[model samples]
Target: MTKGKIKVSSDNIFPIIKKFLYSDHEIFLRELVSNAIDASKKLQSLETMGKFKGEIGDLTIVVELDKDAKTLTIKDRGVGMDEQEVERYINDIALSGAEEFVSKYKDKADTANLIGHFGLGFYSSFMVADNVEIVTKSHKKSAKAVKWTCDGSPNYTLVDNDRKERGTDIILHISDESKEFLEEFRIRELLVKYCKFLPVKIQFGTNEETVKDKDGNPVKDKDDKEKKITTPNIINNTSPAWKKQPSKLKDEDYKSFYRELYPMNFEEPLFQIHLNVDFPFNLTGILYFPKLKNKIEVQKDKIQLYANQVFVTDSVEGIVPEFLTLLHGVLDSPDIPLNISRSYLQSDARVKQISGHIT
Candidate 1:
């Protein structure tokens, strides 16, 4: 193994990233998984353009929790990086491989599918992990696997690994303060909240799904009527309603998606509006008008904001008019800028144009 210091502008960078950079440490999960999704999408684009002459096998992102070991692993079947690429991308701290990939293939429609335009999302893992290890093997033929290890400091170790997969596995040593992330239930909730609509499939550890009868009731065995068969649960919706063409969706379809978005709300939406625009900016979503029990029933955070299908935040007041916040729905656009917290949506010229269109 070779040891080197992570190139950074300041020595206090890790502290800042762990404490002040993000509003909540839980954001680390979204950022890291989003990075994995972006990498997977890049490989898919390459395959589509005939650049990668390899099988595009299962691209499901897996989140594995080892409570006894106090470790959490996020694995992806994506475009893994070689040692040199890892040194340049992870160690350099300022360069975004996604940005360069987009610049290189800007003409292709799939290039816009990436979510980590800002280079710093990967470092968010440091907020929750005392140490992080990356095991990766690039997709190029004859490429050898490499492992990169770093504590929450400037020091990092890089060495050859025997991993025989064309992807990456991020193993995080969960910190005591961030032990909540080590729970399978907590991790699953985070995935459902932030990544249900992601283009790539995401699977948390196996869950049992009770088998139902033909009449939509629990199935029973001959000996015991209450007994039912259960199967493994797959957590995410690979293709959500918003990603589908509006013409192809019916009212029931939109309503079904609304339930998927806000499962707790038992009431059906009063009306719905599907927004799809592509000229000045890329935006697509479904806004629901829920029946209000009272004038104050209108909530501020009912609307969720997403960028390239990864949930950013529900607090989008700066990007949209105040009255618009009264409506409950989802808004997805690849053009908007997101800050560190990924909570406060950044307002810019393009975002203003988008807000105006929504208004």
Candidate 2:
């Protein structure tokens, strides 16, 4: 067992993060899930590069909530970490493991899809949790499983864990002030908002589904009602329409995605523009033009901006021209720079190029 203080520049870092790190405390869910996605992508990249020889089992990320225990856990079968890696990445503030991994495997792997850019994202757990625990075991065959725990303070403890899986589990002990997150509905809402279009599958819980017969028809009971079975409630679409190539998608595909984006809006989209560019900056998305009403009331800020498919903001004033804000859909770019919270965009020349291209 080992115990030490986190290597932060200031002792008040936890308080700062809990209070004002992000304008909205709900952003902690996005940050933590994004980190889990990054880990899964990294493991896939390694497999592609012939570095990892193990079987890549189910990589689905699961968000589990225990209301009675006052705990919420984000579990991922991704690239886990050993003790040294945890000390360097989690203990050290602002040192991003994703950034380092990208730099190391830039030429060998599909690193652009990685979502984490700031190391401080993990600490966002403190925003809502009084204590956090990370149980991880590295992909390396010889690595031992370890557990690291922190209590919203600089002090932390690292001890051996009995976890046998090659992945990570982040267990957050919900604080009294932030007990709203422990609710199943609240967590589901956040997952839908931020992770609806993520590349990896996210399972919240299980939902009853009508069992299907061998002929692809719903199985019916003796009462003539459909037979129901429980299945994993996957909240996000692993591959959204925007992520696909224009050549592969039909007109209905665009309209279908629009419906998925705006479920409440009954009207269909008029047309769509598939924006795929890799020259000046990496950007891909689908922008939909909805049928206008006779009232001519312009609705702005329908466009959502994403950094590596992690929803950053819908208010994309600087990334896209004001005129395009009336259009609905998504714009994803790894080139766009973001602040620590990833709640706002930072000024950059690439952003201007993206905006100009949209124009």
Which model scores highest in lDDT? 2
lDDT of 2: 0.91
| Residue-level lDDT tens digits of model 1 in 142-251 | 88899999998889999999999899999999999999998878998898888888888887866555567788887667876666444435677878888889999999
List the pairs of residues colliding in candidate 2. Answer: none
Give one clash count per candidate, in the order shown: 0, 0
Specify the poorest-scoring 10-residue window by lDDT in model 1.
225-234
Deviation from native of the Cα of residue 299 in model 1, angstroms: 0.9
Q: What is the clash tally of candidate 2? A: 0
| Weakest lDDT window of 10 consecutive positions for candidate 2 | 6-15
TM-scores, all candidates, are 0.90, 0.94
TM-score of 1: 0.90
